[model samples]
Target: MHDSHSERMSGSETRAASGLALVFAFRMLGMFMVLPVLATYGQDLAGATPALIGLAIGAYGLTQAVLQIPFGIISDRIGRLPVIYIGLLIFAAGAALAANADSIWGVIAGRVLQGAGAISAAVMALLSDLTREQHRTKAMAMIGMSIGVSFAVAMVVGPLLTRAFGLSGLFWATAIMALLGIVIVAAMVPRASHPLQHRESGVARQALLPTLKHPDLLRLDFGILALHAILMASFVALPLALVEKAGLPKEEHWWVYLTALLVGFFGMVPFIIYGEKKRQMKKVLVGAVAVLFLCELFFWQFGNSLRALVFGTILFFTAFNLLEASLPSLISKVAPAGGKGTAMGVYSTSQFLGAALGGILGGWLYQHGGLSTVFVGCAVVCAIWLAIAVTMREPPYVTSLRLPLSAAAVADTGLVTRMLAMPGVADAVVVAEEAAIYIKVDSEKLDRTSLESLIESAPERAEA
Candidate 1:
């Protein structure tokens, strides 16, 4: 039997994946760097309030959520690089605006503008264009890892940057980062030779409704939404807890974050290894959610103690890192073949929307009720998510395949039927417009020789 397996990436693939991952890291660092210190810094700005501070912290998410899908769609129409170019410019402008802002509302406006860039989907689409189907998952994972690393770095560095240059200076640094991203996009990233319709890459309008209605996908989407919501909401009060309740000075906050993040990263490894090696993803996922719930509860019960806060922070980051890494993998497995792009677009939107809601909700709870209320709200959300997660089916082991087709084959219904009938082929979609076929198959069982022979024998049809 011919196994449908991926090979080690080529040098070009490594370069492309790494460069783009760095691009994502720079952008994410800019956003995350503000998260740890924004609450404290906002207090000094004119018209500052707890609610508005939360809004400012999360305002970018609102614009990002609203624009991510549209940006992906636009990339499909106009090409990926152009969309990325525009987005980087917008992000740079937002960073500059934030850097110059003197009031809380001004910062909020800047954050909103920052969110408006909404290039994540476009960036992923470009990655798909640049890489082979077999290597795409690795590319995606690189980007995911970059985001996680950026978060850790940002948590540790945000305080130091604020101490050195102040909040406005931090924004200036982000603007510089954005400019650097633009340069990387232009020079380092490879260009696609032709405009390819990547069913696994960019959003398809027709696929949106079906993708959204998928029960399993919906569960994952809601999981990410609740996860990020709790994250944003918790941060609204966490810094305050550190400063006021734990008596940690602002400058020393990095020590706590560095310690917690290191512990969390180490703690997440075993679960990841066990889940992947033993095929216990569902069990691991449920456990992570439950741990997240308990982390919040711990925050509520031990909000005033340094040791408890340290322990809770460690647990919180462990769960966060695990979920962050796992959710995209699950989505890729669970999403219908050929609709991966649309499914991911929706997933990204949900993630950002949750951040926005978390900020708004967390701020409100903190303003009216207190940190305890924020923790309680986060716990409630996690509990509901955990309930939903319990009913989810374990995702099957599978991978996507994109095969080029001639124009004549595009019209051949029999070709699709034959492909679908092949053993280990779980789903097959023939997109005539794209002149390609997309398939999902059990990699271990797939008969690649038969499939390749069939494709080799098919006559090429002339394009119109």
Candidate 2:
């Protein structure tokens, strides 16, 4: 049977994938690095109304969610570089605007502009352009790590940055960082054509509905949306809980962040390794959600002691890390091949919208009710996600095949059709020069005897 995900990546694939990964890391670092301290520091600024403060915190997500797909389509039409450049330029302006602001409204305006950059979808599309089908998962995983690292760093450094240069100084520093990113893309990064188009596809509306309709992809998207909403809402309630219940000082809040991040990093590794290697992804993902549900339950009951809150925080992040890693990997595996970019675009948008919604709703919830209510709200969210996750089907197993190519192989238009007709073969992608096929298949139903007989009789049709 034919299979997908078999080809070993070429040197160029590694380089381009790594470069795009770094670019996204730099961009996200600037955004996430300010989040941990935004609420505490914004209190004394002019025009610092509570509602406006929430907007400042969430404005970027609103913009990023709204613009991500449009910017992606723009990149498809105009070229990746131009859209990336424009996005960075807008991002820089937002940073500069924040740096010079004396009022909370000014910061809100700056954040809105920063969100306007909306280059995530474009950057992902560009990575797809650079890597072949077989290596795309590895390429996407690199970007995921970049995002994870950025979040981890920001959680730790957000407080330290504010302590040293204040929020305005952080803004200026981030602007400079973004400017450097622009230079890297403009000079150091090599231009790549879309692998499918390898020519101009000038910005056209990416068909969005197909991704929205895929049941498996839809489940993962819901996971992402709920996951981020919980994260944002957690912060809204957590700081006050630390102050009123746990008696922790504001400046010392970073200690909580640092410990949770470290613990979560170490704690999540084993499950992540086990799930991927053992092919127990569905179990691990559901178990993680169950843990999240328990953590929220714990949060509602225990904020009186620093130790308990610290433990609860650690547990929460551990589950968060697992879901964050697993959801997208599964999405990549299940997404339709030709429209993976569009699927990802919708996925990113939903994720950001959740973040924005979390911030806004969390504020209202906190203002109206106390800590218990906020936590109960998060528990409700995880319950919803867990119910959705219960419905997800087991993913198909992928197999790799290698063959030597000839001129005849290049010209065989019917080869793909023949491969698709094979029993147990769910999906197939082939590379001519590489002479390899990556396939998704039903492993339990694979007809190994028939496959061997065919290869024995027709050696040229041999499987790798």
Candidate 3:
């Protein structure tokens, strides 16, 4: 409704957000640090094969996808920190296992264990617990920024670490980082004063079916799935292409990653501004998918040349960063009222599953048909995604508003109807159990003052 609604965070909100952001960054850094070097270095492991190596690279996603919902459910039952602490311990154990392993299967097993720690939902829930409703979006934004920064940092530093110590050394470092995350959770993050229902933050089991059935949300889910599948599958070939074909040493791999990421980051900004400010998100999104298709074609044709590889990489990351930032925004804009958390949970699961499928499929393609085939597959996926995206409706420019409702308002059958009839309100859900009403409203058209007055005028009575 107004910019001031989220402008300031309380001292506690700041502290909690910062602490949790660091914890999330550390965990993600562990997962991403191996992406650039894994294809090449993993060959030294016993029982290594291209297919097995691809499995190892993507093994974490399999476990992460499987455990994510369970971890969230456990956290809801047992409390957030306990679940987080257990998850970190599992991650550390996985890291240690990977560090000591001599075979690709061992590494895969370790990666699976690492992913089993699945604390993302718990961490977000904890952040929601620590911040006020008005400030929750800003707090979540902090975590999102932390993830982007972590990806950049991992790409730059991962090669350096691997060169200095070796693959096992990198695993050891990840284990150490996981341990550090445990310490941060225990000492740095603030505890909630009491257990919170966290309807806004945690998934509601009942909302799952409806969220899955929503056609727009289903499209977004498939978009993320295709996006990450391409991402993981591409890397199966990209690192090897850099070394064997492009003639870059493994040690110098970071140069390509760092340069490409920097260029891509800068390139993504203008598109994002145009998409948001110009209200041209669908256009930008489809354009990015087309660019992704072109990038795959470039890789397929010109991957052997150093100069072409770099150029294609820059273009690839540019398209990637844009899509990565835009998809979640689209979800928020399209998700039905009271179903945001459920929609997000499904979206995340799709992303992780895509990563796992990408690894497996990419490995198979590379093993049987070579790198060119992998690129061809990725291009085909992008082509399909682009075709589907083109037919989708433009997402409404709406923000969800949560308002406190009196007991009488909760009992009133017409509350949701009245809210939806109000100017700019696109959807409304009234939850009697929580005594709250959630509405999606077009910010530019919303009459905040009138909405407030309407809520104030709603009849009041004690619960029966």
Candidate 4:
């Protein structure tokens, strides 16, 4: 009857999306605020060793990677709100523990506990529960933007907070943020009247095997893992380099990050536009990885000068942000129809594991071979990723849609055949139990008016 995609988000839908985005932002802000300052101040803890400090930096990722999916599955059984409350409380407690800890081991324990909260999947599931299928993509995109902003803000804020309040105070602030997230959940977030498992939003058990075995998806996963490994490892040395080589003081570090992040954020926009608009995503991705390789090399060779540190940091983030933004979009493109959530779940887990690996790699290399060694190690990792990324097939530029279907449509045995026969319909899945259809379509080629007309026209019912 009407263009299904044309519907705007209702007031309730808008509220739900915005509130959940805030919750996501709060949690991530807490997780990331430590990245910039940890290396400089972490050494003050009792019995702190470089390796152990690295562990402290990455400990949360280990637990987060393990528990992320389990938390979502658990929410499916117990309900979304309860799981969110519990996650926030656990996160707060962990932050408090770290704030009070005196030894490196204790801080590591705190970080592990912090990661154990693992509520990202749960939050996304909740968002899915609250939004209409037509608006779900937009809702999810809002959450994604919030995360990117949170990371940028954290990088700038971390140094400022650490300098003003010290390490313990920084942890305490994260604890407060977690507690605040609980308040937002209770006071602001709307309750989902019915929570359904969405193949596009929540991980599907049946979809996991195929998603994991997907060669291109697997390559992308490795790419994220390598990307984060470089991030953690680089951060482990970056602060030290700034202080020792650039002769910058610890308190002034925020200025460098703020400026670099600002430059990086703006610098990547043209590349993103070129990639998406020009349909040269593979070229952009490969080129970004290559830039990453060179940036690491620059850091290893000439990072001792102040200008090099600043310029190199700016270049590094430009490439880093581009890849970070590109990888998820690529995952969406590469994943099978109806398996986006599962593919993303696996990709996220790989990312966390990489964070853990990078921390340890950075620490050991820095300790044994000095600051340059960390860059060397990160350069090698980027080199490997560059090699792998070059072989990726050109992605199909398509938009994914999950639409609620009428019972008659669900019962129509030939519904998929009819849709697939459409000019721009790339893939379709009729999941009867979920009372919905998942589709991938080339936006440029798809005639939305005709497609909707066919869907509403009539269904060829299966023979009873």
Candidate 5:
């Protein structure tokens, strides 16, 4: 809400955000590549019974969900870069293990270790620290954009790489890319020692409950989980259906993926513009979810036809992109401004867990219930998530103001309480060590000079 010039991204913050984006994209891109081919590839591996194979495929997600928050908390206490470096190193080890696995168990072990490096939460926290509160959203948007780009690229290239070098080669390539990412992070990011008093490294103990209690926030979180679940499940079924029902060759699936990604990307622009520029985020979000629901229904009935699969897949992705971009923006608009980073952490965890559940459940359903059941199950999940989202209240935009305080001023709880009552102030948190007061307020109401006047007279400081 506040247009204070403080929100502008400084040059250093921009470069730091860019580096963080590369880390997120590189890590995610590798994981996504397996989605397109896992079910098919698993069938050919020697020790992969159908049941065990799904476990192997989905294991990475479970580990990632379990570790992300802890990893983030560790970064807060230990240093973001160090934690990140450890994660990348673990990821590289996992990659090499998976690359050389002769049995399904070995692949599963690799996946579990890979999940252990879960650095996404840490990466996000670092971005927040690097930029001013005013520029936080833009910095976050860049991260979101990077993830979208990575997923798109992975989808397009996966099948081609599978054809060119086989699945093992994909793992090897990801390993190499991760090591390269480690080099980038260590060499490019600033490495000054942070005083323990000046920075937080570990996970916040209070993250989950507050995030879960907010109805609007909960709705968005549920939607993300459902959205990613649908994505994971559909890929499980789509490629096999394409080859078996539609008579497309396996290698040529890339042709379809490339076409759909390119087109779906362009198709999402109008909805994004409408949501942001026209203030129609809710309307657009609902419409996209509705479209995706119908696409699932259509796929259930007609996915056997190549043309029908192509049309349905394209529609699914277009709606997915629209919802994905819109949801995080909506979260920023709605979250209690003081707790945005925490909210995102919870949201990210739910999504990774949902993807894990989807892979296992979808695989089992495919093995037992066949095509009709798998499609029906995912459609029902989407329909329920849609109902939950439609009932949420829309949120107003928020802006934060930060006031630098003297070390002595940081100890005055009474002074901090008084500032919370100021006109337009909604929430306040004072970090004494940094002499910074993070305040949420109506974006339209920032009066910097008056706010500074208040800060100058804080109880611990002499009124000047």
Candidate 6:
């Protein structure tokens, strides 16, 4: 079970994973760093309005959602590194444009431009190229953890940056970070030796329709859209609520964010453990969404006091962090073997679209009906997601693994039958062209020794 040789990542794998993680962190940090302070400080811009400000906050999502898939598709045509380099340059340009803009619409344009540089799928593709099939999951996890950290850091740091240097300064700082990301990519990250199109890793254009039509996958996609919409909408009014309703000074806002995020981060750990270990994912997911609903209601009704606002913020984030982590894992669990990448692509698009919708919708509600309406809107969104979650079938607790298969094993008509007969092997597919077998297995019941022995015996059987 603890074979070091089989488990340990090679030196190059470690470097590649770490470098790409840094690149991801840098980009996400820049994107998230605006969320906390934008609604409050963006008023200083010429032509700034609540609606336009909200548009500015969410503009990136629109272009990002539109272009993320296309960028990835083009990466396959040209190359991963070139697409990444071009995306980073575009991101920097957008940041620079925003930094110089004195008007809200200018910032919105800049944000849209920033979104145009979408590179997430390409990055994932490159990561898949760099890592062996056995180590790819761990590498992907590394990137996911980096993103979570970046979000937390941004929440705390964004307010402080705005307080000290104003909105323009923050944009300037993001530009610098984007430029720095380019340097990291060029200097630190290594190129993939064999950039093959992996069905488990890269979206297969032909698989798009089926992935989209998958009922469970569609529900999950809607969940992300609603979740991000709730997030963006809530933030549209939350800063103003903290300042005007709670009487918290603008400069000290970061303290509240830091405290709430810390609570959210640490508080959700137990629930996540319970959910995964107990195999109660659906229950946990529904419970988290319910908590979100209650939190929004609390804000709507009792958010005037500083303590109440802080409490509500903490609760909201606790649920948010839980859902944020759970949704992707669920997507992976629900996706069919050899179709995970396509499922994820759709999920990512829904997430960005939700952000865009939330921003625009939050702004409209705030302008027309005030802060309370924003909360109510988010609550309504949560209710819809809750309904969807309740109807979803309990997801199987399985992990996907890709094992190399010799040509002999692939030629065996009994290969699939034998693999499927193994305990814990829920699903298996033989991809002869890649000389590999992709399997979904329940780790708790899997017998690794037996599985490896079966594969090792294949070549011998062929010779016989």
**Top TM-score hit:** 4
lDDT of 1 by residue, 1-464 (tens): 12325477877778889989998999999988988898777789999899998998889999999999998889888988999889988998999999899999889999999999999988998898788867888898899999999999999999899989999999999999989998988888888876567778788889999998999999999999998899889989898899889988777788888999999999999999999878899999999999999999999998797888888999999999999988988898898879988888899999999999999898889998988999999999999999999999989877888887776777665776777788888888888887888888888889998987766555542222
Error of 4 at 232 (Å): 0.5
Give the Cα lDDT of each candidate. 0.88, 0.75, 0.88, 0.90, 0.77, 0.90
Could you tell me which 10 consecutive residues in candidate 5 have the lowest summed lDDT?
Answer: 195-204
lDDT of 4: 0.90
lDDT for position 365 in model 1: 91
Q: Please, what are the lDDT tens digits per residue for candidate 5 over residues 1-464?
A: 25436646767778888888898888888888887776666667778764566666677889899998888877877778888889999998998999898787888788888888899877877776776656766787788899999999998787888889887888898898789889878766655345232222223455457767988898998888888888777776788788888998888888787788888899999888977766677888889888988988998998888999999888988998888888877766676634666777777788888888777777777878776677887899889988987897755655555556775567666766777777777777886545777677765665667777777777535432
Worst 10 residues of 6 by lDDT: 1-10
Tell me each candidate's TM-score. Answer: 0.95, 0.85, 0.97, 0.97, 0.89, 0.96
Cα lDDT of model 2 by residue, 118-185, tens digit: 88877776776777654766787788898999889888787788878888988987788788878877
**Cα lDDT of model 6 overall?**
0.90
Model 1 clashing residue pairs (backbone):
none
What are the per-model C-alpha RMSD values against the true structure?
3.0, 5.1, 2.2, 1.5, 3.4, 1.9
Give the backbone clash total of model 1. Answer: 0
Query: Which ten residues in a row are the worst by lDDT in model 4?
Result: 455-464
Looking at model 3, which ten-residue stretch has the lowest summed lDDT? 455-464
- As for candidate 6, its clashing pairs are none
Q: Candidate 5, residue 320: CA error in Å?
A: 1.0
Model 2 weakest lDDT span, ten residues long: 198-207
- Any runs in candidate 3 off by more than 4 Å, and if so which? 1-7, 460-464
lDDT of 4 by residue, 37-146 (tens): 88889989999887887888878889999999999999999999999999999999999999999998888898999999999999999998998877987898899899
